[model samples]
Target: MVVTDVSRPDAGSPGTMPVRRKRSRIPGWLRGVIWAVIAIAVISTASYSTGAAALTSSNTASTALRLALPILLCALGGLWAERAGVVNIGLEGMMILGTWGAAWGSYNGGVWAGLVAALAFGALGGLLHAVATVTFNVNHIVSGVAINLLGLGVTKYLANLIFAPVSGNPRQSPVVPKFDTYSASFLSDWLGGLEKEQRVGISDVAGILRGLVTEVAPLTMIAIILIPLSYYILWRTRFGLRLRSCGENPVAAESLGVNVYLHKYVAVVISGAFAGMGGASLVLLRGGADYLENQTNGRGYIGLAAMIFGNWRPGGLLGGAALFGYADGLQLAGGGEAVLALLYGAVILVGVIVVVQLFRRQWIAAGLGVVGAGVLYAIYWSNDTLPSDLIPYTAHFVTLIVLAVASQRLRPPQADGQPYRRGED
Candidate 1:
């Protein structure tokens, strides 16, 4: 009898290749859109059921966008550095320097000058980081910590010397010029009128759109433009490919005649520029026309978290920022009640997860998802209001939960944060 192993059909065939089935899955962008639609539906239902008008209010959306901008910029900064295999834990410090630079320049020149100074100062910070990590080969984390210390100490001394002399406050800078904001006059008016009509889904959509077009700042517009620009430069352009190569494998990149050090230096510098722009946004937009001590208040750290949550992609980073911003905005717009509505939305989201896990035959995960959904639903049913203290930290709590869930799927650069020297095999 001839024994032919069906499972080993290609075992003895050296030149033959196995034909595998191609699995069809949803495109990433389309999946994102589908998830977004589900989230919106859940939140809209929560808003109506709970009578939380602020959940979909235009003012809340505006506040969320304003609050998200700084985080978005900082995350972009981190993305640039990490993509070049340079770990930048000094983003907070760079932002500090930018704030001081913005104040000094705006005081001396104008808001535009302030922005230029911020970028210059931020680039300086990045340069210092590059000198420590890339040139001297210091531990990336240690160098980052030192940069943070240096940024804080240097900015403090400068603030005392420059700001105190003018404002008579060591911790505060003198009044700086504020940037003008634009709104679509007739269109914004029409949207506002439509939103005020309060026609459930239609009104909510109108309200969200109105917020986008109303009182929009030039910097905000520029920041939004940078998202797509960064995507194009980093994913489409040859320079981006070379830079990213340095992060993935410096030795391999150098073998291919790519300038690893130069690319890293450029990336770190651009990182600092983005961080500085974030600081400039605070001073010029929502910071009461002046730089204040600790105005950042850990926003740089939050931006880093946002970056990680996004899995080092610009689009993901934007979503993370928007999520945190919306949570905070809900707290600001309607206090505890609005946030309570988020709990209901969370329940719906978890329920959807349970369904997905079940479909995938992930029995254990589906069970956990069901429990989580049940617990969240119970919380929503029982609590009419979240505690005052907890409400202030709503965004942070949401960030933590999101990071925990997203942690499973992250795929960072292979050589990220690894020390590399030229010609070292």
Candidate 2:
């Protein structure tokens, strides 16, 4: 029997390996870029044709970047873990701990101190995960679940003990210091025009660019910088190759004198560090708000989706993050139709009602569809817009559509969740 390198899709299958598609000639990152360009072109054309506002504007671009940063960092963390052949479901746990650490640090020292605490706490969580998965050879998923549970309990308990007495509650912390956001006046004027709030011009490009360059968090700048840095480190460094090899085939790497255990530990720990910083960045963006329980929400899971969508490459991750972030920002941007924001919200609201009623049972669902249609008719009777707060649910649906369509191209590491030992056959 042949012992194949497990990272490749065709590794153990030999003759059964699949052929590539015609479009496979285009790399995944390039494909994503092309699709993005096409999407912008199509949306722009439709907007111009209908005499509507531009699909993209300075406001939406800025908000999307802020939304994308945490998810991008978490996705990068996932990339590191999976590439090293470890399935790290513990990113959520690490992020939770990071939030607590950040709150404590900020409350005592300052925002920068909170950042340090977040990284340290996150690394500690990674260490625990690595010990369970790598050292003891436990199931990766099980280990991750356990870490999440522990993180939840420990953070809450610590928050009560440390912050509750002071803030008078176990669920929240005292406010932390904040970092200043910066703006560029020239970029705002040149790239984002002053008066085309009602029209689409070639100048919309400048608006989007201005949003990207100004009124931004310092951490957002750092996160953007980290994207290129991650790509270079993972693809170009000698240590990275060894780390990837450990994921693909640890036995082969060991045979070639690589330190498989060390690499796995390093990858997991680094992943945790990134996750922790992601939590800190999130809170810092709020600018001195008390850290509350469950603040990370489900962004960690979204990061995993982004990792899959990116085809597990750094550049692809960037594209994936941007797409998801833009989707998230759509509600705020009224789906890029400032005039129709309310109308869109009413339609979406009724659609959600129909879906939920249907999921509860069949007859009730059918009834809801009829009632929903009537409600929809009533809403468009005046074609009036709805409140911005009512439109906040748009991103979840946008995420679903994007994931359903884009996940078709994903290919995960072959032996990602497999167990291995130094002398395994």
Q: Look at candidate 2 and give me any clashing residue pairs.
A: 191-206, 191-207, 342-385, 342-386
lDDT of 1 by residue, 1-425 (tens): 23334357554465545554467898766766786777677777778888887878888888888888888999999999999999999998888888899888988998899889988888899999999999989998999888888988999999998889889999999888978889998989998998899887878777777887988888899999998899899989999999999989999999999999999999999999999888888898852447988887787888888888888888888877787778777788778888888777777766776777677777776776666667667877888788999887864564464345333357788888998898997
- Give residue 63's error in model 2 in angstroms: 1.5
**Please, what is the TM-score per model?**
0.91, 0.79
lDDT tens per residue, model 2, 253-275: 89999998899999999998888
Candidate 2: worst-modelled 10 consecutive residues by lDDT: 338-347
User: The CA-based lDDT of model 2 is what?
Assistant: 0.73
Off by over 4 Å in 1: 1-18, 286-289, 357-375, 406-408
lDDT of each: 0.83, 0.73
lDDT of 2 at 422: 71
C-alpha displacement of 144 in model 2, angstroms?
1.3
